[model samples]
Target: MQRIISFLCISIFLISCNKEKTDGFLINGNLDNVKNNSLVQLFRAEGRQTVIIDSTRINEKTFTLKGKIENPDMYFLTIEGIKGSLPLIVENETIDLTVYTDSIFASNIKGGKENNYFNDYQEFIKKIRTRSNHLTEEFKLAQQKQDTSKISSLRKEYEVMMEENDANDLNFMTKNNDAVLSGLILERALSTNKLEFTKIKEIYANFDEVVKNTRAGKVIAEYITANANTAIGSVAPNFSGPNPEGKTIALNDIKGKITIIDFWAAWCGPCRKENPNVVKVYEKYHSKGLEIIGVSLDGTPQQKDAKQAWKDAIEKDKLTWHHVSNLQYFNDPIAKQFNINSIPATYLIDAEGKIIAKNLRGAALENKIAELLN
Candidate 1:
């Protein structure tokens, strides 16, 4: 069973041929158990940012919110004290909801294209989660009973389930190419190393012009462009940043026959933990035409002395290699160019500057270097 649970919503964009309505959406909600005077809020999520769009207090076990949105996007409906937030796409239309306080996600939502998609996705996830939950129980029993055959069988079953889940996600993204939700899905796929650039580019190419014009579409379009240069088989994008001494270092200047571009920061726990492994790799391989550039994302508004922290970490960790940082945290130009949202990220390139691999760590990082240089 796939352990990841991603909520999805799909809706057909409803357009009126005769009259265009500038008026916004009306949400009519009913609380099943009658919790009166409680606050309800709506939040709009764009990329990693979120803002509340509308909010109201329930009266007589009911509530209403009216608002207009420039584009259709994902929105979360939360009632004060509700255990879970109800996710539904919000568009410029009348939306109806029957909230089940005990099971918020099970609440019926309809009346808009966004609601249609939300319900469809809910039904789809219901089946997937049900089977996955059952598998979890059986696997637990197998482990307790020391049933080796059953354990292996369940592992295989889980792997198959994961593949199917991935395929289903891709299918939805492909079939709903014209909807803003498709762009959102594609944007998520772009964030990870799961799909290759070719696949991503292919999907982006198929999106309708209208989809491309939406906010989500524009964001994904930017992601696609940034990833193209860093994707395996493409040349690594060269970047420059200020070293600890106020001197500058550029990727093209120090890139050896084999190179590793390591993005990390001092505040990052995982990055610090992985530092020793990276140090080990560098020590063993530096003499054999392997080089690494440590790009420190250390400067945040909260840090008292970002530069001192960067220098201190290099010395404390014994990171003896080319290191540079704009001290701009994740906003570092190099980090932005590479679309790096997480730390301990890396890219391995050959002498010609073509990216050969990415995000390798520990023994895998060493093994890949050995394969090329040794």
Candidate 2:
């Protein structure tokens, strides 16, 4: 009898393991305020579009969706005629969903480890937003009372909260390196510019093969390739665009001993403000074998004349550097190639065209130029 009991225990353990590692997904879903027989669709995001994974009809305000996914990927569940869709991390496990049809974004999605991580992250974000709203109200009160010290204190507190939040996100992403959510998290980290590019790349490389093949992962891979164009120690990609006179000018044509690629726009206020510092740096370093090629992102749909505005800003600011523009705003091919998101950006390269630094400004700009040339 004792031997039989031992055999039974092992059998039970193996059965449980098999159940846990089921082969396909099953979504047991119910809706609030949704009529019976309503249609529900499950969509999977491909490269640039979403393809339907499965669909089911609600019976008595309940529906079930079943499918097989090779990986845990982002899927959206939509109820017919609903204004919003419920986003879920679909894994090969039984998912329990409660659709708040009135506000679909508030829907509850509980499933595998991936969904749990995402839900926990959403809760954290909600708390941060609540604190931010409270801080905004406090700042208004402090302003109305003209309490300078209180205002300063609140500002510092806000900054601290943001820093802590960013750190928390980084920690989560690093801890869940194998999670599909890490792909999205790394993208956010880059867009916020909160972490160094090298650190971001390291974290991205830590992701497992499955996560790296997801849509989000593919997008980040593309961004990494584009951003590498200006990454330090990498040879800068040479580009040519129409100058202010409509004549084409190439980077190789005006390559100097120390070259500065300046990405800015006439409409950018910060660029306008920093023009003088750039002029000072250029005036000091031009005779010292430093050359600057100003790439202007001047075109905007609202602007009356893109080329005229570009020329005026250069002349008014007295920017004597060789300037070029496609007048295509941030859509400029060169800007797209460099993945430049903000203006007043700079890339400092050596005589061999290898990028040495990026986004330097003011004293940093002048000092780097001096160190290289002087």
Candidate 3:
């Protein structure tokens, strides 16, 4: 009887062990041509920062990383001396990855369903990039030959291809709303500055609660909320800063005019290039109730002479307009309030301070101002 009881207990213990749930992730990775015992690092993106969570040494071209995660998040697996890093969604499941030196970006990742979906999205983006490169090369050739007809046709084709890509990406995100990858797709769409605020809001609303609650999803949601205030038909957020002469100028002070709130930096090449066009528009329309407030995102701890740089750029570019900067570089509160992640950003506000358009450049800017002022 005693022997039989012991046997029953052992059987129950084995069964329980077999049925035990795994609460953490196990990433089993293999890197071809990687030296044995080489250092490998894992990084997780929190907000705009990439934080290293763990590191391990590859043994015989293989390494394993284990960690607990509350939800799916973006992570990078990097090998020492490797030129590229492998990005994957880390979830609470076993992930099998194979990285090759020659094709690190195309490394094979299996296991987590989120990773699978991410891999698919990456493949689609790769194909799009390849086609875009081909189209660009053709465009250069057409330009060299001065073939206006070919250039027009190629430009139309490129635009259509890009539109189709965007549509497909949106569809994929909609269908996979439960996956973290969907949130990432939406974030990319926001960054493109092409999608309308209403459309972005619609997409965000369609996302599943699980996706919306992820770190990336939270960030996207916040961005959408921030953008809503500055979006077309919405009231532009008011701000105040010191102009070049060290006098405080508020957006409210410039109310009752067609205003272009231009966010730029002296060091930004694109901003510098676009200045002449801005200058042309300002000169043409300043007399017709068109006003511009140039906000400079120049100034860093290393550059104590940022104020001078801002003044010089304005002088050199011939931008004779109300210019302001806190000389806080990227840490400018106005930039943060407006969610100005990129330079060369503009908000066209009407007499009532409602944003009428955004990111208008060159001919677009001129045409819009012409329509409003005339």
Candidate 4:
């Protein structure tokens, strides 16, 4: 009777140990051609901040990480001195990865099912980006050579490629609605203005409850809800901030004129490039009752340099107009009120404060201003 009781106790202990092993997550990675003393850092993004979780030194070009997570979440693996970090989904299971120092994106991530889906999507995006870059180069060369026909053809091809990419992205989201990766993909699509509000809502609704409960999923839902208030035909959301000279300005103060609420940032290359056209338009129409409020998405109080950068950009671009910002990059209250996910976004409000149009750029912007004012 004593021997039988001892055997039962040992069996239970062994079973408990086995359960713990299966419940915890492990990441065993082998890196090819990594530097002898390179350090790989693991980070998890929470809200707007990235928190470092752990760091490991490369030994024999291999490393291991172990932890337990309640559910799948995105984590980043970055090597010291690398330009970009590799993103992967970590779940409560063992995962094996093989990375080459030269090209981390092409690295193989095996074991985690979510990571597999995420990797496939990343590969697809890489292919599309390569093609887009090639076409952009060709278009620039054609423009320089004054080859209008070739330029037009390339432009058409570029548009087709973009449409196809969008279609594929939508298809992937729809097919993988239950996967956490779908939420991540949708969040990115929302930020890039690739998904309309209706489609965003639809895709979000189809997401699994677990996916919808994730941090990224909550952000997507919130963005869709906030954007509904700023849609065309809706009254423009009211906001205010300090101008460059430290005077408070309100959106209502700019009422009774055709106002362009320009969302931009000092660090945004596209915004800087688009500034000349905006300056031209402001110069042409400021006297014609057209007003622009440049809401800069620059600098937090923590980043004093962003304030100087904002001032420098305004001076260099000759943006002689009302400008304001809370100086909180992407966390500005006004930007949140208006659901601004990307820079270089604009809302054209009429005299009545109704949003008349959105994202009107270059010739489209000039044409819209002319039509409204003239």
| Model 4, runs deviating above 4 Å | 1-25, 31-37, 44-50, 66-71, 80-84, 100-103, 116-165, 191-194, 245-248, 265-292, 300-304, 312-321, 339-344, 350-352, 359-374
**lDDT for each residue of candidate 1 in 89-108, tens digit (9 for 90 to 100):** 66676766788888786777
* Candidate 2 per-residue C-alpha lDDT over 1-374 given as tens digits, one digit per residue, 9 for 90 to 100: 13222222211100000124557888887777877788899996553357999998889988988888776666777898688566666767777777777777676665466765676666666677668778878999999999999999998988887777777768888888877777766765666677887887888888888788876687678778888766789999999988888899999899899999999999999999999999999898889899999999988877899899999999999999899988787767898788887888899988899999998998988988989997
Q: What is the descending TM-score order?
A: 1, 3, 4, 2
Question: Which of 1 and 2 is the better model by TM-score?
Answer: 1
Instruction: List the candidate 2 regions with Cα displacement exceeding 4 Å.
Output: 1-105, 109-114, 148-160, 222-234, 245-247, 280-288, 299-308, 315-320, 326-333, 336-339, 363-374
CA error at residue 150 for candidate 3, angstroms: 8.3
lDDT (10s digit) by residue, model 3, range 1-374: 13222212211100001112368777778887977878899887553357887799989889988888777776777898678666667777777777887866657765455655655666566666667778878989999999999999988887787777777777887788777777876776666677877788888899999988888788788788777776689998899999999999999897647999999988999999999999999989999899999999998556669999899898899888788899887668888778888889999999989999999999999999999999
Q: Which stretches of candidate 3 lie over 4 Å from their true place?
A: 1-26, 44-50, 66-71, 119-164, 240-250, 253-259, 273-292, 299-308, 314-323, 326-333, 336-343, 348-352, 356-374
In model 4, the clashing pairs are: 299-327
State the C-alpha lDDT per candidate: 0.78, 0.78, 0.78, 0.78
User: All candidates' TM-scores?
Assistant: 0.77, 0.66, 0.70, 0.68
User: Per-residue alpha-carbon lDDT of model 4 for 68-135, expressed as tens digits?
Assistant: 76666677788875556777676667777788778775667654457556656666666666676688
> What's the number of clashes in each of the models?
2, 0, 0, 1
The worst-scoring run of ten residues by lDDT in candidate 3 lies at: 10-19
Cand. 4 Cα-lDDT = 0.78
The residue-level lDDT of candidate 1 at 114 comes to 42
